[model samples]
Each structure stands twice: as structure tokens, then as C-alpha cells.
Target chain A: MARVNNWQLGREMSYWYPEERPNKQFAAVFDINKCIACQTCTLACKTTWTSGKGQEYMLWNNVETKPYGFYPLSWDLKLLEMLDGQEWSEDGGRYEGRTIFESAPAGERVLGWRPEDEDYSYPNVGEDDCAGQVDGGASIQMPHMAWFYYLARICNHCTYPACLSACPRGSIYKRPEDGIVLVDQGRCRGYQECVRGCPYKKVFYNAMTGTSEKCIGCFPKIEQGLQPQCFVNCIGKIRLAGWISKPGEERPDNPIDYLVRIKKIALPLFPQFGLEPNVYYIPPIHVPTSFTRQMFGPGVDAAIEAYKAAGAEGDDDLTGLLGLFGSTEEVLARWKRSGDTITGYNDKGEEAVSVPLREPVSIRPSYDKLYQITRVNCP
Target chain B: MKKTIPKIVLLAFAILVAYASCGGRTVSLSEVVVVPDQQITLDPTDGAWYAHPYHPAKLILQDMVEPRLLEPSTVEVEVTAMTDGKQIAFRLEWVDDSQNDLPGPQAFIDGCAIQLPTEESVSIPAPQMGEEHKAVDIAFWRADWQAIVDGRADEITSIYPNATVDHYPFDAESLKKDPDAKRRMEQRYAPARRLGNNRSGPRKVPVEDLRAEGPGTLSPAKTVSTGKGVRTEKGWSVVISRPVPGFLSKEKSSNIAFAIWQGANRETGARKMRTGWIPLVIRGAENE
Candidate 1:
């Protein structure tokens, strides 16, 4: 029998006990289908917070078109190629599980590829090289069918953030109270240790101050009884911000509930990395289930079913899903209750949800005092 | 006959001797002029002496003589000149608290010249040897420029009675790098670090005050008019103020994407900055 590592279990799990938890575990849920990729949120955030010097290269918020999308130039594919390896499965899929090879035969790998390789390549439309030509009535070279969806992303403020673990200096910490992750500006030495460790690569160094900065989750506004600026400012009304449960509470019968728990439109981004990211997404309905499962997790089917069942009996359309799960109160309640297990009942009276709770974790942010010099005239 | 001649000669010689003695030159030896060494004594009772108006002369001496020895051969001397003129120089040599030779006090002249002044009263150069004596005579020198100005060099010289050399001993290497000395100089002369006139701390001026036509600068009635091109939740509708002219062309649009973020409390009417960006693409207009 495998030895039960209760300590390890304790190290990995976190729960939202309504009476004990500090502020609800607030999160923003986004439906990929509704996102128009306008980048208004990026500009809004840029003008508000990141317009300062040292933040020139920073996008605390960004939206990238997927299938061939990434910032820092192909960051995702490059990291993926590095972590996994050259062999495609004989079964015609890009990956089987997660096996990374040390080295492969010359033809087996895409040779001479690098992360910095695309600095001069124009892969995306409207980029530097292709800008005015689009307006000059140029013929379309790429078909529209190859177009992919865009995902606007920021710090998820994860339940088990890999960024927190990668910091050797203990500068990264999460608030046990609100579950917001932050880097202590004073303690951070701009080591880039956390940057290398985080699978998401959200931690960034500010060139001006020589320290790492990341999303603060809009905690100050949240504390003042307001939703996050990102959630509140979503022009598409596609983002919802509220609390989630510790996996064992009563579930709601709303659209958000259907998307998160029932229909599972809103599923965790990548659970196998095991960081347990809090920001969930509603699976793109047009995508294949295999791809969806790979993007979300093994449990995408159950979540989708839960979403379909939340609406009135006769409705089968997307609007019904939106109508049933869109309300904040029911969705928030269901999230608060769904901790270690799914919190709603089904017609069969069996366990209807699978919300996994493993261990409790915390992140504490710190600050440094800096001196400024000013000139004065004597009297 | 011989006896009679001898008697006549003796009588003549005796008469000549008596005449010479009676007419002797009446000379008296010049009264032996004794200056009595000009009995110089430093008037300890003087107000100036008690007030220490004159800089104290410090003698830095090296202890070459052992106490157990009957007599020591050599002593190294370092003299620090502290007085601001008005003082003279003198050296008193003695052996075992006994005076051997005392040089008369000399006044400093000619702008405290480095070379010793050679007069009946002369100022000796620093580190000069005293009158040689056995049993190692200790010497004391006074080169007070101030005493020389006061014409009290005679009195200042008397302070040393059976004088013993005093040394200002220190590690030359350590003094060269004295941290405390550096700190003292810095404290006395360096400038202090301070913030602005409002030294309490850095003041954060409101963001609106920093920008022209911002919230703080606008009148309440004009608030709605100032934020025109910029989108706010309540006063605006989603309009393509500027459209990408040929968005559908093969060439990429300079503005290929449009992103939106909603303001919090859009209904109740609070003007706050948006938090996050959600990307949107332009599909052909519904009318088109």
C-alpha cells in the first residue's frame, strides 16, 4: 500500500470555508466565444497602471490569438517544444502525454528553432510589417478558416501558483485571506528565479527599478467593496468576478454555475501543471472534445452537462446557457460550496461534481522603502 | 774698606724701593658686573597665565633612557609649535632633576623664521640640542610667538623648573587612517541629507492635478464634455470613431484588434479606471 503523505496532502490543498475564509476567493471567469479581441482592456490597463517607465515592455494584461499566438515571440510553442520533444505520436496526435526527449534525430525535430527566432518574423496580422498593406486592398494570402480564437490573460492568482514555488528569496507570497498572489518589491532582487519557475511566465522584471512586478488582482478596489477593474471594465460583459467554494458546498443553478460546474464552459486552464489556476474558462464550443479535454482536463464532459441542465427544460441554445449561468449570486454560491467535491444534486442522486481539494497554501507580499532626491534653495 | 762699601750700596737700594711704593697708580678693579642670569621666572600668578591665553607648548619625546640604568645615552625629540607668536624659545638641560646649564630666554623675531635667531637673546629652532651634560639632562623649550609680542619671554621661560620631556606618542600608521577623525571632519563640514521643504516625507499630488483638463481642473458641469473621445461607461455608445479602411484585405490592419474593459458600477455612475482587457475583432458591419 502507498504510504499516506498527510503532510504533503496538507501542503497541496486549500478550501473556502464560508465562516473562516477571508473575503471570498475572488476570480474572473471569461467566455472565450464572446471575446472580440479588441484589446481595449489592454489599453485601459496600460494607461492606468503600466504607462510608467520600466513598464514599457510589460503587458500586465494581454490578448493573444491562439494556434499561432504568444508574446515575447512564440513563448508558448518554444517552451512547449523545450519541455516536450520532437516525436509526434504514430497515432497522428501532436502529443501523447508529456515526455520530453534529451535529443532526437535530425529529421525528427524542427531544426534551428529558437524563442528569439520570431523577433523579425511577421506571424500575426496587423503587426509591424503587414499594417498599411491590409488597408491598401492587398490580396488575402491566408484563408479565414485557419483563424483561431484569442485569449485575454492576466495573473490567475492561483490556488497553487508555480510562480510562488520558484522564488528562492521567498519574495512571492499569497494572501491567505483573499488568495491574491503578490511579489514583495523590497525583497525581490530581480533574480528572475520566479520567472524561470513559473509555467505561465507571468512574473516580469521592471527595467527601471530592477525588480519583479506582477498583477495585484486589484485587491485595493476589492477591499473597498468593488469588483476588479478588469472584471468591471469588460466591455463585452464577458467577465464575472466573485468567490469560489472549497469543493463541498451547495451548487447554484445559474449560467455561471452551468459554465463552471454543470456544462463546464468555465474550466481550469491547465490542471496537469498542478498549479490549480483560479481563473477558469468556458470551453470554445466549436473545438473538438479531445482538444478541449487536453486544454481543460479529463472532467470537461461532466462540467458541460451540468451547464446544459441548468437552463429551462426546453431551451438548448447558447442564450439559455447564458441565461441560466450568468447571474453572480448563484454562481458565487456554487463556487463557494464546490471545494473538495461537486456541490449539486442530479436526478440519479449520485455524486454530481468533482471538485478536488488537496492542501492549504498562503502567499504574503512585502514592500521596500526607497529614497528620493529633491533640490531646494536656502532662504 | 770692603765692609764700608757693601753697607753704602745696601742703604742706596733700600731708599729707591721706598720711593717707588709711595707713588703707585691708584687703580680700582672694575666692579665685577654680575647680571645674575636675569632671574627669569614665569609668573604663575598672572591672570594671563591662569587663563591659558597662550597656546600650550607640547614636547613629543621618545623614552630612550631606562629607569634602571645609571645613565642613558640618547633621547629622540619632537617639538610641536603651537603658539601664535609673542613667545621666545629656551632650553634647560639637567641631569636627574639637577640643572646642568640654562640657556637664557630668546624672543621669536622675523615672522617666526625657521632658522634660529642669533642674538644675545635668540630663538632656537625646534628639536635643537640643549647644553651637553652628563647623566642625561632633560630639556624644555618655549617658542611662544605670543609671549614674544607681549614682551614676557623672560616670564614664560620660568615655567620649566627641573623640566622633564613629555611626548605625544601615537601610532603614525593608525593616525593616517583614523576613522573617527574622518567622521569628525565629515560631521563638522559635510552637508546634511534632507527632503523638500515639506521634510515630513514625499507628498503624492493627485493624478488629476498632474494632467491638464483632468478631473481636478474641470468644472463639475463640464466633466461630461471633457471625456469625449475617451470611452466612459454611461455617457458613450460603442462607435467605430475610426474604422480600419480595408480590414478584410490580405494585408494586416494596423489596428487589427479592438479590446474593451467595462467600468465598475456602470449603472450607479461612478467614474473609475477599468482593470482588465478583453480582445475583440471587427467582423464586417451588420449593415455591410
Candidate 2:
């Protein structure tokens, strides 16, 4: 096991892959509170990619209701149960038990668990089910009818992706340019190590082709300096895309850095897994604190506080950056809002997207009232 | 009593010699003068295979250690091969205590496959389902598809009594539309298994003719081939036959391989048990 610093974990943890950071890591911060599960992002991703045979049930981008929903049906619960009783020391900031690699059974590189085909037959079997009413010591409790929130998910593209580490033939690779993880279709032998090793179950088995496939992070779009389809077509405008610089080399002007590093309002998902997932999320404030803390880490409280503070105080820079989410398809390295327009700059400080703070509004008389005047007298 | 003891001893000696001659897990492709009248069917007792010289190909089954999935509990497969002038056939059988023939929810049926090089141009493709530039053609046989071929009902409601449907859009007569409605209805209930035996048709067939250049490159071929599997009490028996026009050429030897998948073990994709390439040499008419 190799020990490496993971800012998301707030401590060094074990990983199988070496520490080779990317120049400009592609990252996103999703505001969970803003997501309405309109599924516009899901359709956008489906139409762009994953619309082939054997991929009928695949959702490269998905939004499931939290507290009772999972795409692969209990993917997280299974991993948690396998690693049950594993302890984490807050003071020491280290995990005591085995990670996906350390706990691998004899003769295995990573713990292998395969969900049955039926597990994937229905991608939205329990999209919005409610959590069981366990009133005892459970910290996060909600009223009988109104407890669930939408959780949009994609491949984390982790700093230490278990999928990449588990591939025996080295078919799965993480790019050095922007740290996008992809499966080399030509080299994969359909050995689903990446599928079995992924804790989130984002990597999928294409039975028709007899190989594994995963979220490509829209690298073609990313390479051209444009945001992913999911980010662009978000009906709720909940996603912000930019580069996440390495720790100790903080680029404060970077939109992703400002939210994840400077303000620390967006937290990486399941940091305890210790993969340093690049996607960060602003936890849903309405959900129970204990549940949010367990899902996001101990930083949940602080993250929620910082987010609320930004919105309440009208911090224009932070608010302006937030408004830039889904502002335009072009990827923004840095952005700020001035007056009625939000201007986005690329990595080289070249102007990319200049969208209005709000679209132009028009007021016209009602049809009945408009009949009283013609085009010449409409004004 | 004395005469009976001699007879038993002689029988035992003959059996031992046959086992030694065949080697532990290796079989030879024997050329046959007559292809059985009952050909192109998955029958283990077909007379053509019995009349041909047979070798016991032993199989050492193991877990897919690469991705490190579940270890295979069963350890052996019995293999035999025979070829007429027109088609080549292989029959594989193994001992499986459980008969997992239904591909139900969370259930995987038994399956096996045969792989051969598409072209004899380059070195034999990597056994790991062939790599790019070194293409290998594979014919996969699954129990679920076989059951449909055998005219067995494969509806989930029939397979699992407890599986019930409260209501479906197609069930409502008011919502029915002609021409494509029945197919759309079948798609709703039996999304993966509706085509039945016709499922093997290349363009619309469920069982596809696939070729792989390397690990991740398994792709469907433009045309489909013939293969079938059957579930037996002990395990599964399968036959995969194809016409290789120049298989018996005097000059060159051939490489062929097989893979087995136990769906009950959650074996699919890269999680399978396979054998390395086995040389197949055919005797020419001159030798005969």
C-alpha cells in the first residue's frame, strides 16, 4: 500500500496507484439543494453517449432521490456492510480499517463484488423511495412525508480510482492532461475488475460488446475548453466546472478552487473511501446533519455554514461564480459577475463566455389588450 | 469366482492405458469419414462422435484471478472433438451439482463458448479474447437461449411463481396499437429474451458473432454463426460447429480454444474460466 496526501480526506491514506497529479485536474462542484431531478442532464448525457445496445439501462449521468435511492440498488450499502465496523479517528484524521485494496481477499488486487444482472436491469427501480423510519439513534430524521432530496451522480474520476488500479491488463487509464479516466475498449478483455472494484458502481458492463464502459467526462468537450453536456444542460443550473489545482498550489481565482479550497463549502463525496474523488458537492442543508456528515465527512457542518453565509451576505464574487453554473457551454477557468453580465475566462485568461446575469425580459400586453392596438401602436 | 476376477483385472488395465494415452487434459481433433446422420444438434450420444477416435481433454477450472471475482468451485471439464469434411464440432461436459438453467432476476444461467482465429495471417491471438490486429472469432452458448430453442417457456411469471405484475401498459386493450404493439409489449416484459430461437439471427439476434482484437475490443461481427447449448443433470453439454474451408490443408496447424461461464457464480464479461490455445491438426487424405 502506498500512502499519499488526499486533501479531501484531510489526511494521508493508502492507495494502490502512484501519486502523479495532473496539470489541471477537471473538477466540478454540484449544488445539491438546487437539483430538482428534472432529468435534463440524464437525457443530455444519453443523447450524447451511451445510447447503444447493452447500454439501454446505463445512465452516465443520473439523479436519484437520496435517503432511499441508489442506481445499482444498494451499491454504497453493500460496500459499507463489507467494511462495517471500520473505524475512523477524527483527531488523528486516519482510517483504521482496510480500504478497497487492503481488504482484498487472498490472491486479489482489490476486493471483488459483482452485482447480478438484475441489479442493473432497472436503473431507476427505487428512484424516490423513502427511508425506513428508524427513530432510535439515527441522527438525521425527517417528517413522515418530506425527507428525500435528489442526488445527481457521475463517475468521480478519483485521484486514486480503484477501477484503474484493479485492471489487470491496464485497459483502464487516467489521463495525465486533465485526469479523465477512460476504458480502452480495444484492450479490455471484458474482465470486470473495474466494474467490481468501483465502489460507486459507475463503471458498467457492456454485455453486447463484452467489455466495461464508464463516464468519459466528455474529454472531447473538455479538450476544446467546453463543459460537459450534463453541466451545460442542467435544468436546475446546479453544476460549476473548472480545474481543481493540487494542494498547496491553490489558484484562488479558479472557480472550482474558490468553492472547494478557499471557502471549503463544497465537499467531496464519501471521503472516507480515501480515493479523493474530484467531484465535490455542496450538501443539501435541509437533510439531517448526521446523515450528511456520514455521507460527506465531518466537514458537512462547516460546508453548510459557509454556503449559507455566502448566499445570505450577498458575496458577489462567490455568488457570481455560483451564477456562472450552466451560464454557457464554454468551460470557465475563472469567472466574475459585473452588473448584469457574468464574464467567464479560460485558463489563459481569454474571454470565453459572456452571459447575462439574467436573460432579457419582455413585457407585452395581453392578447385581449393587444387587439386594441396594431404593431405600430404596440409600444 | 476365479474367472470373474481375471475379467475385472483386464478391464481395469485397459482403462488405465486409455487414460495415459489421452494425457490428463488434452484432446486431438480426429478426422472422421462419416458425419453423423443426426448432425447439427446438441446431442452428446450422437453416433458420429462415438465412432471417431476420442481423447479426454481435461479442464482445470479456476477463478478469474485478474479481476479477482469468486473462485470456481467446480474443477474439471470433459472435452471431445470430431470433424467431417464439411463442419467441425466440439462437445464439452462438466460436473455441476446444481442445475442453474434459468436466467431470472439476480440469477445467471450456465454457459460455454468456443473461439477460433478469423484469419491465419499472424501469430495466434492472445488467449485473453484476442487483442486488436490479432482478431479471434468467438461463438458463445448460453443456457437461457438454449431453453428457448428447446421450446421451453421462459416468462418470468412462469419461471418464478412469486414474480407478479400488478399491471402493464400493453395489458390494457384500450392502449393497444397494431403492427408494433406486440413487439413493444414483449419488450416490456421480456426485454432481453423475447426473440426465442430466432434470437440468433445476426442483425437482430440476441446471441451475436463477436470478434475481439484485444481485451476491451470484443465487437459483434457483420454475420452470425451457429452454436447451441443444453443443460444436463451433471452440468451442461454444448456444441459449436463452423465451416472452416481450409481447415484440413496439409501444410499448417490450427489453434482453437474454449471458455466456460457459470452464471450462478456471477460469471460474465472478464470474469470467466478459459483454456490456452490448443493445437488442432487434421490428417490429410494421403495419410489416410
lDDT (Cα atoms) of all candidates against the true structure:
0.37, 0.69
Q: Candidate 2: misplaced stretches above 4 Å?
A: A1-5, A10-16, A50-53, A91-93, A117-147, A185-192, A206-211, A313-316, A336-342, A353-379, B1-45, B83-89, B95-109, B113-234, B240-259, B273-288
lDDT by residue for model 1 (A1-379), tens? 1111111112222221112232446565787767777777677666555543334445677777765556546555554555543223453222234321112122111111222212323334333221122445456443222235667788878765556654533567888767888876645534344554455656665433335678777777656544566665667656766556554441454324445554455777655444556788765554445555656665556555544454534334333334222332122323223324324222233333333232245432233224344444332
Give model 2's share of reference contacts: 0.17
RMSD of each: 39.8, 8.9
User: What TM-score would chain B of candidate 1 score versus the native chain B?
Assistant: 0.14
Task: Tell me how far the alpha carbon of residue B154 in candidate 1 is from the true structure, in angstroms, after superposition.
Answer: 70
The TM-score values for the models, in the order shown, are 0.40, 0.70
Residue B184 lDDT in model 1?
A: 45
lDDT of 2 by residue, B1-288 (tens): 344557779777776666445533323332222223334444665644444444334444434344434565445556665555566666777766566655433455577777788765347788667876788888777666666666754444445546555444445675566738755654433322233312321122223467778754666565455656655678776766666536443356677767777776766556667777776655423226
lDDT of 2 at B121: 32
Model 1 ranges with Cα > 4 A deviation: A1-23, A84-147, A253-258, A300-379, B1-288
Worst-scoring 10-residue span by lDDT in model 2 chain A:
A137-146
